[model samples]
Target: MKAGYVIRDQERPHFITITVVDWIDIFTRKNYREIISNCFRFCIKNKGMILYGYVIMSNHIHLIVQSRDGKLSDLIRDFKKFTANQILAALHNEPESRREWILERFAKATETHTRNKNFQVWQYGNHAEEIFSLKFMWNKLNYIHLNPVRSGIVEKAIHYIDSSARNYADEKGVLDITLAENPVTDTRKNSEFWKYNSYED
Candidate 1:
């Protein structure tokens, strides 16, 4: 299979989205989400990944990330590969009621691509876009936090524990994130911050 798209620059933080094949709600489970969170922590510690912001949704994840070692592409590629393998292992070894169906779906997804030997957990292409301006950065940042809210999963962005919104909201969260050098204008106070369509392709 062809390699995923490459980033033009490693110095700039990029907004990336990683989605499950067929839009599977794999992260609905606590353990599955934990796997992702644990991987992020590991990457930050060992892989020179600097996660500025992130959010884990039922079927996808959004991240504002960069690499200190100028290996953003390498870090993302490995992160996906590692998470897919670990999640696949969990599917087989863990007690999931939808085990058979999930495995079959992943296997089916892989059959369409030569790159995957057995199963394909994450769909190819992160849909990465470099954050070029402070306005754009804040836009993506707000979009990440507001994802759960837009999905009707939460009443407020700060209420979503799976996202870095809590950190921006001055609350402690599960994963640690590097704050942006530019002070984040109060998103809550500014309704215009979230008015833009964040999911545009």
Candidate 2:
């Protein structure tokens, strides 16, 4: 939890990365991915979370998000707590071949921290980076969308079903997201418009 990565402004959108404990590939399964999607939907509908972009990878997820009620920290805390319990319960109830292994890892992760009662699912601290400018916002959005492609999971970003890239491409994604405007195009236009209109003495 570095000071730079902490979420300072609750109302501003921030790019966040939430990783699984020990970088476990728990989200390779559809059920696990669905759990994440459902949690996001719940937050959006009930927790004042304004999700702008997201992508769920095998071991982690990236999101560009804000809080409508200016309580982003609380929303993130609740999301992590609820999702961790649901995922742990699913591992116990579902037919997972790697159940024992995964559970052992989660349990081991909690050994260093007394706060965890039994297991720790997610790695602490979301590595939150606030989106300061329009260019930075678009940069983060593109990064989130292209993560799967960069990881060799999909050829095109839109082909990834677990990402908001599809939504940006005019296709339905797993969960709804607030589509961010393309600031690069707008910036270019603005620059061109003001190129020759500067006041000179």
Per-candidate clash tally: 0, 0
State in Å the error of residue 44, model 1. 0.6
Candidate 2, residues 1-201, lDDT tens digits: the string is: 789999999899999999999999999999999999999999999988999899999999999999999988998899899999999999999999999999999999999979897999999999999999977887788788778877888767777899887776667888888988776554542442122222332
- Candidate 1 regions off by >4 Å? 1-6, 182-188, 191-201
Each candidate structure's TM-score, on Cα atoms with residue i matched to residue i, is 0.90, 0.91
State the C-alpha lDDT per candidate. 0.85, 0.87
Maximum-TM-score candidate: 2
How does model 2 score by TM-score? 0.91
The local distance difference test score of model 1 is 0.85
Q: Quick one: best lDDT, which candidate?
A: 2
lDDT of 2: 0.87
- Candidate 1: tens digits of C-alpha lDDT, residues 1-201: 223345789887899999999999999999999999999999999999999899999999999999999888889999999999899999989999999999999999978669998899998888888888877887788889888888999877777889898776667988998977544455445443334322223
Clashing pairs in 2: none
- Pick out the ten consecutive residues of candidate 1 with the lowest summed lDDT: 192-201
